[model samples]
Target: MATTNQNGGNRRPRGGRIRAGSSRRAQSEQTELHLLRTATWLFSERGFHGTGIRDIADAAGVAVSAMYYYASSKDELLEAVMRRTLDVLVSSGEETLRDVADPAERLAAVIASHVAFHARNPRAAKVADHEFHALTGQVRQDILQQRDAYETVWSSILSAGVHDGTFKDRGTVARLALLQMTTGVAHWYRPHGELKIPQLCERFAEMGLALMGASREGRALEACDVNLPDTQLLLRRAELTIEPREKPTGL
Candidate 1:
């Protein structure tokens, strides 16, 4: 015998609620974001091997079953977090620097955007910087593609600068050094610290330009006409919402 509705029609158990339209998509995105936030904190704190699906679900205030709605497994959840960071970095970089032809200005914009992103999304940045070895096989490859996309923007900028005689051709060494310096900002920068995002970006932009030999043209920092998108505006443009938290609070 099957359960019957008030009208006397038999009703079958539904596996999941079917949500339609923009409201449904918005809700799904929200849930996925919540999961990413919870997982980022855990993965950063406990290391990937120490964190599990139950840990993520518990921290997120959702049941383990609900997690399956967003991701098939914890690995997938981690990958989503990684992808979100890369998406913001790559999309924001390309969008902001796309129209600029001068390599010095383009590189300044890249540094400003990169630093601001790391400052705004330190936890996610830290996780992406530190958690690569934990990801396996195809997942790692896919994430690296996103990573490469972002890196390629910098590479192109550097190569163009060299070709146009605006920067020194120290080869890949200079590029790697610049990236490492800018990306490492996430490790120690704090929202309450003396330098805010904009100022921090400016400082790093100056440093990056100097590293690339732009100082010779007296275009090290303020002289360079870098029209970087405002950090908050850039985040909105990228559709990335990163809620700032205290250092010890699990993301």
Candidate 2:
């Protein structure tokens, strides 16, 4: 006998896709996300090897084989999380590169975008930065490539600024360090707490510029420094809005 639903029609079992877009992938995606979240908690609480697939399946209320349906292994799940993460970061920075041509402006936008994302999703940030090493073979290489591409974008801008005399930085080392510094925001950012995003961004921007040897002026004169022309030492940032992040396409 066919199993009938409340409407008296025979109902398909779980994971069924049918006409009228009735079985949306959205549910599947949500289930996958749920599984990821549960696994993340487990992995964080217990080491990845310490946590078993059965544990994740039990926590997610899915069968062990069902877990394999979405994620081949815990490592694969981590890669998915990391890939989405890097994609967002790289894409956001790319968008930040579009409008503003100044290296200083580009740098600020990158920092701001990075800070916002990490502050907003610290868990994802933590996992991406730390747990990524847990993946091996090709998955590790893929994550590394994405990360390297992201660094290259920032490096290019910083190098351009140095060449044009807009920014005075040591080299890729310091520039990369500056980029990594923003991740600290992930360690202690609380959304509904004391500081808001805009305020934090401003403070971070000032700190980063200051580190590059830029000084803050008094209230009246200070406003002008934000627009200072590109010299061997200064950058005007008041008008420093970046263009949207875009990817390169074929000619």
Best-performing candidate as measured by TM-score: 1
Model 1 misplacement above 4 A:
1-29, 215-232, 242-251
List the global CA lDDT of all models.
0.73, 0.61
Tens-place lDDT per residue, model 1, 52-88, is: 9898888777888877766667777667667666767
lDDT of 1: 0.73
Q: What CA RMSD would candidate 2 show?
A: 12.1
RMSD for each of the candidates: 7.2, 12.1
- Reference-based lDDT, residue 227, model 2: 37
Worst 10 residues of 2 by lDDT: 242-251
Give residue 66's lDDT in candidate 1 (0 to 100): 74
Clashes of 2: 9
TM-score of 1: 0.80
lDDT of model 1 at position 199: 80
